[model samples]
Target: MDAMTPPDREAPAEAPIEALLRRRWSPRSFQDRPVPDAALASLLEAARWAPSCFNAQPWHLIVARRERETEAHAALAACLSGNNRRWAPQAPVLMLAVARTTFPQDGSPNRHAGYDTGAAMAQMAAQAVVLGLQIHQMGGFDPHRAREAFAIPDGFEPYAAIAIGYPGPADALPEDLRAREQAPRQRRAVADFAFFGGWRA
Candidate 1:
């Protein structure tokens, strides 16, 4: 581990779960290191295997490696919201996750497109952990600007902007974000959301 690397912020799971799942977390601070091409491909490969409704496979990623795709990376950075733009640009890689709103088999609306796309990104996040990397998916972005910048087709919708790289020390981030980076991870109890047989209010 590098001297600048932060300690693992593992989740305190109520039940046993995959070690990777426990280790996975989104960090705003990233080291100024390039992610290898092979590792990026592995992340996409993991996403490719995610199951989608009717096998539509609507998820698509527009990748921009800061050192490799300098112009594109800057353009993508411009699409982020002010808050995210602060730290996200520091990441070595940036990506825009988009989803096709219609099925390829038929030009009909696919309500699950966004849901399926999310699943794919989830897989990518796990794979990042495996590669000693982390991804922070941000909804705080200008979708309209992204669409214009990328010339995204009408049938596709920009879902999220992703920042990918090795985690860095919390102190690397701005004071506010540094606090969040060092904060303990929290989640709602399983009983709060899981209803065995019926909905509970």
Candidate 2:
């Protein structure tokens, strides 16, 4: 239940998959330990390698480590919605994922910008699992406030707010969250979505 023995929230995959993918799950309880700079660098590096359309690499991460940037971290936390503000601020790191909506070269709209940003975060999430860390990405935030707080520029959109740190006991969370945290992981069967050469309604 402590950081040394965090709960196992691995996904019950229907088919065999890499342990890294199976092991990753978002958690609201994070330990007090600060993520090391090296580990942070490695995570960003993993994200940097994610593939993107036209190799545009349109993602940008605004990171705030609680210990290192206390004020900045607080400012970022203030942008979270009430539900997220309850648990997300406990993590040692907070990040805002931003996407450049326009192609830099031509100033034209890039429809895949958000998709590519998500791919980058996916890679970062995998890296977190590898580092014995966990990340919970949240859509519950005020993007306009985040833009004002961070001075995010024009043509850039805030996609998600992320809380990252080592996992902690489910009991550390409030009663409701703890219940949800310990609940079984669920996913649709592959057959439910995958089809053979044609779409199914």
Candidate 3:
């Protein structure tokens, strides 16, 4: 039972910095409002500016509006476990992000592609926060089905899908979820995870 908060909160005095540090979070309850094309475009542009190794920007995004795809959306919804399926359907946009396995002119494995894609995803999510949007990254989808359904090219690997929209009422979420809706954020202290100079623990 991952916890969350109701959609209502006072915007911080400094919105941009607050959005960067405080506004970003993953919540399943999404309102059905239409996400503007310009905002979406800006989010993608932020991802485009993320750093990549050797300038090999290999992340690919395939976006789908939940209402637009009948069979596909149903299949996608079913692909997620019951809990995720509940609120994911309410999101207006779904993005399937992929990474290419080969570098141009080099047949060698592109080991860093996934890392670069992850960075781009982080940027996109952060940008969404700045734009008053919410995004949930899902690891429960059927990757094989996604590849076939989207006709993903041979070199590309389907990695993750994100559900994007505005936050919905906590009441719309399941009872178990509603209880933890306004939970506070948590993170490990820096000393716990970061090492100073050498391997002397």
Candidate 4:
């Protein structure tokens, strides 16, 4: 992953914090514009700072820009399904988040690698919203293909790939996507998904 930082250096503040948490929502349509380099950098920077188990810092990012990095983008996006393909192209950038199991000390498996990486991704996604950007996580990619394409060695596992860009008009999206554009976020109620203490009887 290209670790590029934006020139405008300002530590992330509260607005982004709330936006990241509340305003963030996945959308199919994306404005056909290249996300500012600084914005991308800021997002990654936030991700890099996320806390990890044993400070493993296992998250790995692979970024693909539309024009400048077509080969990598295509290889990454090729793993997705047709649903994502419909409007994913409009996003200026695509990212693949990966993790390495070994921490270079012992050969033991790092159980927290995937979890830590997920934390980092959450940080990045939230920060992106603060920056007026949006992201969608996709699980439809081919792992074996991603491993070969990215030349990921034996120790590392590709966790997930994300589509990143500015939000676009829902109308511009295809009928299927457009239909769900204004749909509210669906979730099991807090009571359903959460438990007060011990496992439910």
Candidate 5:
């Protein structure tokens, strides 16, 4: 089994995170277990509270629980790249985060929709960490396939797909993934990303 104390698995941060940032870490190996409905609800509730541009709240979360939403679960699963498919399916829950590209009231372009959707997903990820679940988001999925499979409307765009569940044994993964699981997490230095008086690239 994976370590019960997930926080210990976190990479040393340049600066501390509040409430420990739930010490969140992403792992591909997930136990063959079902996420409780109550926990799932809390995750969505967390996402719902994220701030949006102009209060537009353009994110639409499409959730497919392995047990409750089988067809949807399969469709979402199918959209994953072959590598992701190997591990993501073991998670009890899968999710697609979609962004509405226009304002609901005026139909004008909402240039900030993608940013808003990201905020919502960030909130959801924090909640998952707090609840002892790890989420793995994939950009490798075919967006076109996801749109077709889910019949996503023209104005809505799929931003990311997530796999959620309890951490599983590293042995469950292929050798490459197993090595990846053990590697230290990486991030650019704060100076590289954060700037002071003026912007710096």
Candidate 6:
């Protein structure tokens, strides 16, 4: 398992979790194969079902496969952070997740737009594992560049760039990324972050 893999579902746990959640990982290396349309639709469908504030479901995804949209893929790659640019370019599918900051029904401000978008991404990640694929989501990208490149409409915010593909050998990544790939997964205790009562004094 790589650093991104979740805890084993079969192992004893404080609470039960889905096996797909345990298997999902955000890996830097990926096999150079185009994602099939059916698999892609499944991933999007999972996202479609995510819960959202007032069921607004603000997430709007723009996906480009390496072989199908070469120029657009390159354009998206260019908008990524320098570190990500190195490894993400090889992914077969690259996507931009955008959020609509207002309700479509009456054009009211949506304070939970970001939160809703996150829920959608979480669904897609889990679905990817079910499809034997992995998705690495990154915040390191120029929003302005992406907006201009993709002609993003007003009131819509570009949230994250996602690289989707089948996991490849870690050795294919740069030496630094390879080391990070094999590192132990770390997380804070549930008690540390999840407060049950009033804020800790």
RMSD of each: 2.0, 2.2, 4.8, 6.6, 2.2, 3.1
Cand. 2 TM to true fold: 0.96
Task: Give each model a TM-score.
Answer: 0.96, 0.96, 0.83, 0.87, 0.94, 0.92
Model 4's number of clashes is 0
Report the error of model 2 at residue 48, Å.
0.3
**Mind giving the per-residue lDDT tens digits that candidate 6 earns over 1-201?**
232343421223456777776677788899888889999999999999999999999999989899998888999999999789999999999999999999999999999999999999999998888788889998999999999999999999999999999888888988998887767656566788788877863
Off by over 4 Å in 6: 1-15
Worst 10 residues of 1 by lDDT: 1-10
Q: Please give the lDDT score at residue 26 for candidate 4.
A: 73
Where is model 5 more than 4 Å wrong at Cα?
A: 1-8
> lDDT per model, in order?
0.91, 0.91, 0.75, 0.78, 0.85, 0.87
Q: 2 or 4: which has the higher TM-score?
A: 2
lDDT by residue (tens digit), candidate 3, 11-90: 23332444354667777778778788898898899999999888788899987766666566665665565567767877
Instruction: Tell me the tens digit of each residue's lDDT in model 1 across 1-201.
Output: 122224548887889998788888989989889999999999999999999999999999999999889998999999999789899999999999999999999899999999999999999988888888999999999999999999999999999999999998888888998888888889988999999999996
Clashing pairs in 4: none
Q: Given candidate 6, what's the lDDT at residue 193? A: 77
Candidate 5 displacement at residue 197 in angstroms: 0.6
Candidate 2 achieves a global lDDT of: 0.91
Error of 3 at 25 (Å): 0.4
Q: Clashing pairs in model 3? A: 4-180, 4-181, 4-182, 5-181
- Model 5 lDDT tens row, 1-201: 122334446767766676536367778999888999898998899989999988999999789999999889999999999689888888889999999999999999999999999998888878887777878888879899999999999999999999998888888899998888887777888889779999976
Clashing pairs in 2: none
Off by over 4 Å in 2: 1-8
Least accurate 10 contiguous residues by lDDT in model 4:
1-10
